[model samples]
Target: MKILHLLRLGAFVAADKRLERKEIDLRKLEKEYEEEDDMELEDLDMWDERKPKQGMDTRKLDGRDHITTWSEAKKGQQLGMYVNTVPGLSEVELKNLFDLWQMNMINCCNFELTFLPLEEERMLVLLPDGKHLKDFGTMLRQDKNCLTFVVENTHMLCGGHPEWDPKRPGKNVEAMEKWDQYHKDKKIEDTKKKVEGWKESIPVENKDEL
Candidate 1:
């Protein structure tokens, strides 16, 4: 009878210890949730601060007009290059080329290199300004080794894509609208072409089925 009583006591103690551990875990989870809620509230406040003030000219505040004029003035400041494959050239050689250009030709600001999405062979190089970009183009044109590459001013390629002008304080809403329309029109044209191609591809007998 004494041995049975001791066994019961041991089981009760183990269950009590388990309950205490579960309570501790619950408290820790609640503390974590409280911290997350505090962070979310802080983010909401920051977002509210960015809202435009009532009765204010949003264009003036956003720098739209200023950016438009600045973009026109500094038109070809950035350049985009399409890098074609160079036979027998290693990655180290390509890096050396970029390093050489940065070290010698680029002044005031450095070049920004970005690879095109899904196309590793293509790259876009953002030059410092119009003058430097023109100079770089001239050098590339003269160099026989760079024949495979194609370079053009970004404005030429994108019909003046709206960008933030450092000299301006506001956003370029007008340019942004124009770019949006351009892309919309291009999309419509592309869709029309695809539909026309599909229609032509269908046989006269199969046209009823489609």
Candidate 2:
């Protein structure tokens, strides 16, 4: 009689498990249906023509715009470049830097370096003005193993003449080789340090204790 009672309890539990699975399946189906409905609504909305929403002219926002115009866009040409004046950077300093960079890159191509994008990698273009910037020059500076030569003298560096000739093949080849070696050496050193660190972090086991 006790065994029969236990069998009845087991049947009830099995029925409950099947019912729970059906509930879960129903929930998943309902969620999928809702997602499909959302996607359809999005597609319909895309067909509707809409204009960009303009920001409301608030006094606080208007004040900042006015300050930017007076500060960065002090000149006629720079007025176009003035998006917003960053904090801490003075208006005059920002304008001067922007004008110098723009004229050096666009007007004169007088940059110390010019970065050209390649299929797999990008190439740096060295222009006259780029030499003045610490980061730009540092990137091109060669180590003992690499060759470093002046592509442009003081005359060309100053943006003295409007027209400048192309870089020499000899200089280009030497610079490229140097940069390649520098990167290779750096990679090898980094790998060695990483291996050393990993070995140090490994726990030492005692055979006697085991």
Expressed as tens digits, the lDDT of each residue in 1-210 for candidate 2 is 434544665577688865553434434444455465554443322222332222333432323122222222221111111121223445455445445544544544333333332212112233332213322222223111112223222111111112222232122333445789999999999999987787677666633342
lDDT of 1 by residue, 95-174 (tens): 67556656656362444443342233334555533334434543443343342334321222111223433354232344
Per-residue lDDT for 9 in model 2? 54
> What RMSD value applies to candidate 2?
29.2
TM-score of each: 0.30, 0.19
**Best candidate (score: TM-score):** 1
lDDT of 1: 0.45
lDDT scores in order: 0.45, 0.35
Best by the lDDT measure: 1
